[model samples]
Target: MIRKANISEIDQILAITKACGERMKEDGIFQWNETYPNAEAFQKDIERGELYVYISEDIVLGCIVISTIMDEEYKSVKWLTPNSNNYYIHRLAVHPKHQGKGIARKMMDFAEELAVQKNFVSVRLDTFSKNIRNQKFYKARGYKQLENIYFPNQSEFPFYCYELPLKK
Candidate 1:
């Protein structure tokens, strides 16, 4: 069950992100850390009504941000669908306890469905360059890898951007 997250659910979402950050650090995936995706960022997502939480029997197991808002940082990258409006996925995470249960894939499926429903042209995301697991995941989903960008606080290594075009 995926639904828009309310401002009241901010703390729960933050907890999930914090736990995810810890797990990523443990796994040596520095995509997120103490500085990124804090409460303020989630608040912005909630305000924009872009944050979607995956819940089951009232338990929030995961969340993903699906929005058309383009980040200024993305301007430097050469995107496949540069001129088209597209859905972007950010801060997508499944609780460690719920990992390997296809939750992330389900959230992505939902994102793609929403994009199609909205008549969007494509889906865009940036994955940690060092996270081979996620790179494989996106590639298997037909997302073409594009230019690399960096999140200075997250890592000095480049983050590869990917796009999945909905149009043939």
Candidate 2:
């Protein structure tokens, strides 16, 4: 089951995030190396009602954060269309032990469903250029890649922004 994250799930979320961060670092995915999605940042996301968790049989399999609009840091991007009603996705992480089971794709489907229910037109996300697997995953899921957009923190590394139009 996938649902909105509660405050009680913070510890588990942090553990999952730390593990994912470590693996990304070991695999040379520099976008989220040490500072992108930390515990404090996720806590703030939860407090702001942007975090979502995927659970199965009482265990969390993965998670992601969805927002109605991005922060000012992302506002400068020319490709990021300013649609207040569109959904923005970030901080997607799957438990290493639970990977290869399509959990991330399921979470993305859930995000689209939520966006549709909220009357949003589309769902947007950004992934590091070095994370080829992630880029392919989104592309396979029907997200279109926008050129020339980079994450504010990782300016050294460019990012490919993707958007999936949601059904009304």
Candidate 3:
């Protein structure tokens, strides 16, 4: 089941982030390297009410961060429509052991439901260029790709933005 992340789940979230970083490195995914998604960032996200975790049988299996809108850093991107309340999803991580079990999809479904409940018009997210599987996955789920955007911290790597309209 997916639920709001509490302070106690921070360590597990960090472990999952580290595992994901390691796996991505081994697999040549270029978004997260040695310095991204650290514990401090996760702590900030949790404190800001943007973190959510997927749990199963009392074990955390995945986590994601959602926001009503992105920071000013992403304002240049044209993917996300300028609306008062559009949901933004970030840091979507699934435990390596529990992958391939449709957990991420379920989490996404929950996100959309939340957006609908909140009366948001759409949902937006981004994926690393090297993460081909993610691009395809999001595409299959009705998320259309926008222009590639560069991260100031990692200018060498670019990310593909995606958006999905939630209006029925």
Candidate 4:
């Protein structure tokens, strides 16, 4: 089941992200690191009621952030829909142990449904340019690739932005 994250589950959520970061590093993905997706970020997401967790049998398997808040960096991107009002996705991660179970896809489905229900223009997110798997994942779901954005703290490489328009 997917639901809003609670403060008590923060520890479990952090563990999942830490493990994911390690696995990405081992795979030379270099997408997530110790500095990104830290506890503070998740804490804020929970406080704002934007963080959602995927759980099974009372254990948190993955988490995703769905918010209307747009990063300043996104303003420079050439989005397909031209409107800035969209569901912005962030900190999407699945526990390394539970990743192959399609938990991420389910959470994404939830996010897109929420967007459609709320009448949002689209869904927007950024994935590491080097993370080929992630790029394909979004593209397969009909998210159009947009201009690249950089988070210097994360890596020197660019992060590609994607948008899935729900309306014309």
Choose the strongest candidate by TM-score: 4
Candidate 1 residue lDDT tens string, 38-132: 99999999999999999988988899999898888787777777656799999998888899999999999999999998888899999999999
For model 2, the local distance difference test gives 0.82
* Count of clashes in candidate 3: 0
Q: How far does residue 32 in candidate 1 sit from its true spot (Å)?
A: 1.4
Clashing pairs in model 4, backbone N/Cα/C closer than 3 A: none
Candidate with better lDDT, 1 vs 3: 1
Reference-based TM-score, model 2: 0.89
Better of 1 and 2 by TM-score: 1
Candidate 3 lowest-lDDT run of ten:
73-82
- In order of appearance, the predictions have TM-scores of 0.96, 0.89, 0.93, 0.97
Which parts of model 1 have CA positions greater than 4 angstroms off? none
lDDT of 1 at 17: 89
lDDT of each: 0.90, 0.82, 0.85, 0.93
Q: What is the C-alpha RMSD of each candidate to the true structure, in Å?
A: 1.1, 2.0, 1.4, 1.0
- Order the numbered candidates by lDDT, best leading: 4, 1, 3, 2
Candidate 2 per-residue C-alpha lDDT over 58-92 given as tens digits, one digit per residue, 9 for 90 to 100: 88778899987675655665544456688889989
lDDT of 3 by residue, 15-96 (tens): 8888888888788876775678878878888888989999999999999998875766568777545656888899999988
